[model samples]
Target: MASIKLNNVTKSYGHGAKALQVIHGVTSAIADHEFIVIVGPSGCGKSTLLRMVAGLEEITGGEISIGGRVVNALEPAERDIAMVFQNYALYPHMSVFDNMAYGLKIKKVPAEEIKQRVAKAAGILELGKYLERKPRELSGGQRQRVAMGRAIVRQPQVFLFDEPLSNLDAKLRVQTRLEIQKLHRELGITSLFVTHDQVEAMTLAQRMIVMNAGRMEQFGTPEEVYNRPATTFVASFMGSPPMNLLRHAPNADFGGKPGAILGIRPEHLQIGATGWAVQVDTLEMLGAERLVYCRMGDEFLIVRTDESLSSAPDIGATIHVAPRHDRLHWFDAETGKRLP
Candidate 1:
């Protein structure tokens, strides 16, 4: 296990006048054995940052250090890091055991030691029964496990995962996520995982880096990001239904300064008799909970509620909704930054 640190790391394409910067002075400290996920929308530079850390992409400026040693010029193999890619990247021609042992063989490790390492990795990944099976003979989840097995056998100082669960089915993704948690608990390796899915970021990371258009938007635990978003982008991006960001309306009771935006989570908006009036547009029943989509003047709002109510207001009907005062989030309208 090792700590990873980034100091003003940057990446760019072209040079001089035509240069296009993709990463803008990203800096963070990842402690030894900590699992950090970099998450954002597509084309937001999450994968690029992960690749930079893995030494697969060149850093345009600043430095990256692994286990307290500078590795800005080191090659991927020399960094002592193992990566599990989105595609699994298993060789079709080789059996599971051979694929896992290939890296050890290339390094000319002793035959007995290679066998022992492969066996132990297989046991940890529950791939012992499929050691002789080729990649094509296994299911997608099994092949992914084999990829993880390959990395585990390397015993690298850090683990890099680039959307490793993106290809799995919904149920398999959930199961594999639990498996990964177990593996981390047992091995305690420093890991950096990149994904576009906020749910994955929420569930997998001890802390997460939220990126946007190549800039680091926020870095904190899931609870902090969800509860007190740093900016409008984070407020709108991290939640399922997302936080409702309303322009400062002069007549509305939801209080805010003239130039501030009001933010309220879906669950925080309650149906009441003394607040902003809304015209119901639609309602969605989701078993234990319900979502009310309504129009308040020119702005649209979504409210999450339980099914315990005896009745719901009909579409096109008028209803009053009030946001929880203490739960409100305020942002600067011009900069989209959180307001104290």
Candidate 2:
């Protein structure tokens, strides 16, 4: 419901020799109603940044504003933001409806309005049939929905999700992701999500911020971040089994010219009719897909092939592989920066 802004925000802990700076002069603006996701490794300060925006953590420097007004001095409650934590924080003894309505009751909201809001939220979250059930009676996914329902009832200017799906099993996590995406579209509320899972970030975010060691490394749409990674760290972090970055030369050895440090997605490497011969090392079977591990000039690279590649290359067999030139990503080996 509100646009969020952070101007040169920073955070540091301890002092002198023991000092550690987490966020350093981070500046970004989240437009109204946009679903933004902040992604990074475990200690990258992703959650810390979200907590600062929620007013849960006192920012060490810079200013934070919500809906065109500076809210750095305001408390979390005064900011009109609802946060859903990683753990479903429902009251153990409270029923679904009661859990969702607890915040409203504390704010001295009219009982009738609270009832209306909670009921509507339960209906939206498909918990209408289980409002009478307590937290102990619900499954993990259901409890997560209750957590989401609690946030929905508040109708806050912004929604904060702090790794809300990390606890769910893989199947449930996937299911909940779709539900969240649908809920965002239906509510059209600005949401800031924090997660370390690149898959989650890729699937959920319209635009994502990649953070590293408490500093922002890159900010862009999922496609831009994947296709044109800003640095080697991002290049390695955003992919499955990661991108194969091999130190090679633009010479006649591996078929044609190659750049300094060449990055190629596994799926981009394939057996071609005309290419340098590589001695296959191992083969990985992945149901609908397969991976061929091969060696070229003392370097290892993975080639992806669909289930029906017709003639699957055998292990220890010599085969020709051509790098997908158009999809090739180049980076400077020394600086780890993308090539211009």
Candidate 3:
């Protein structure tokens, strides 16, 4: 395993005045054997950043180093990294065994060693029974495993995954996620996974990089990013129901600070008698929880409540809800940055 470093890494399409800059001075140090996920919305440059590290996309400025060696000019193959793409790039005609063994064979590894490597990878991925099966004969999950197994046998210093689970069904995605966690635990290879799914990032990443438009909004553990976001963009982007950003708060005190946007998570709002009176717009029952959509003056607010705690209120009914004092987050109204 190897540590990766990005020092002010940047990317641009054209040159001079018409240049279109995508990545903007991204800098981070990925420790050895760390599983870091790059997550963001579409067109946010998360994939572009990963591609730059994989040597697939050239950096416009700054430096990329792998295991203490500068690799700005290195080719993908020379970087000693394995990539698992969203589409399982498997050969239709080749069996799983041949597919896994192809890389070692091309490197002219001994035939016996190739068999051992392929067998070990197949065992890890539970593909031993499907070794002789062709790509057409395998399920989507199985094919993806084969692709991962192919990478595992190479024993690269780094592993790059570009939305490897996007094509799978929801259930399969969950299953494959578990398998990947297991794989990382057993092998402990340094991995960089790029995904647009925040749930995946939160579940799979030891550390996550949240990107927006081409700049990195935040980089931290899932808990840090979720609990104390650095900016309004992260506050709104990383959550499922998302943080409620109120430009005009219902209260006058404004959480003891003035002239800033207020942020409150849906779950933090409590139905009370002495607070903001809001009209219920809608209610959605989601198994154990309920999302109460309400309109407070001109601003919309969503309150997440446990179903066992309270019954749902009728739509169009006015209700009072108070935000937890300690849970209130303040951000600059103009800059959208978090305030102390």
Candidate 4:
């Protein structure tokens, strides 16, 4: 197990004025045995950053250190790290046992030791029964587990996962996520998981790093990022329906200072008698909750409510709504940064 550090790390495609910079001097300290997720939209450089840490991509500037050793010049094989990719990169011709033991065999480890390591990893991943099965014989989730098992047998200092759950179905994704959590608890290895899904980041990470447009948006626990976002991008990206950001309206007073954008989460808005009048545009009834899509003047809003409500407003009906006073957030209109 080891700590990972990125110090003013940067990446660019070309030189001079036409250079397309993708990562802009990101820096963070990940403690030993901590699970950190780098999350953002598609083109935000999260996967690029993960690949850089794995020594698969060259660093244009700054340093990357793993286990207190600077690894900017190290090859991926020499970095003491194992990577699990989005596609289950398993060999169709190899059995589960051989797949797990391949790395050890390449290093010329003793046959007995290789067998022991593969057995141990299989036991941990609940794949002991499938050791003889080839990749073609397994389900998508099972193949993913095999990929994870291959990494585990190496006992690497750090684990790098690049959207490892992307191929699984919804149910299998949830199940595999739990399996990963349990595996981390038992082994306690330092891990960095990269994904575009905010829900995955929130559920898996001890702390998450939010990225956008080649910049680090925020680094904090899921609760902190959801409750008090550092920027407008984070506020809009880290939630289920996302935070509602409305420009200052002349007719509405959100108690925000002048020239600030008002932000309210869907769950924080409530149907009330004294508040802004909204025209219902649509409604979606989830099993446990409901989403009310409405328009207040020219601004659209989504309000989450409990399913127990005896009556719901009809489409095109006017309804009153208000945001919880303490839960409201304010952001700078020009910079889209959260206002203090």
Cα lDDT of model 1 by residue, 1-340, tens digit:
8999999999999999999999999999999999999999999999999999999999999999999999999999899999999999888999999999999999999999999999998998899999999999999999999999999989999999999999999999998998898889989999999999999899999999999999998999999999999999999999988999989444345556777888899999889787788999999998888999989888998999887973688999999888888899989999999988
Clashes of each: 0, 1, 0, 0
lDDT of 4 at 125: 91
User: What are the lDDT figures for the candidates, one per model?
Assistant: 0.92, 0.90, 0.95, 0.93
TM-score for each of the candidates: 0.97, 0.94, 0.98, 0.98
lDDT of candidate 3 vs native? 0.95
What lDDT score is found at residue 83 in candidate 2?
Answer: 97
Q: Quote the lDDT for 328 in model 2.
A: 80
Error of 3 at 261 (Å): 0.7
- Candidate 2 residue 197 C-alpha distance from true site, Å: 1.2
Task: Estimate the lDDT of model 1.
Answer: 0.92
Q: Order the candidate numbers by lDDT, best to worst.
A: 3, 4, 1, 2
- lDDT tens readout by residue for model 3, 226-312: 999999999999998999999888656544467889999999999978688899999999999999999988899999999999988
Q: Model 4, 1-340: lDDT tens per residue?
A: 9999999999999999999999999999999999999999999999999999998899999999999999999999999999999998898899999999998999999999999989899999999999999999999999999999999999999999999999999999999999999999999999999999999999999999999998999999999999999999999999999998888443246566788888899999899887778899999988889899999878999999998974788999999888888898888889999888
lDDT of 1 at 226: 97
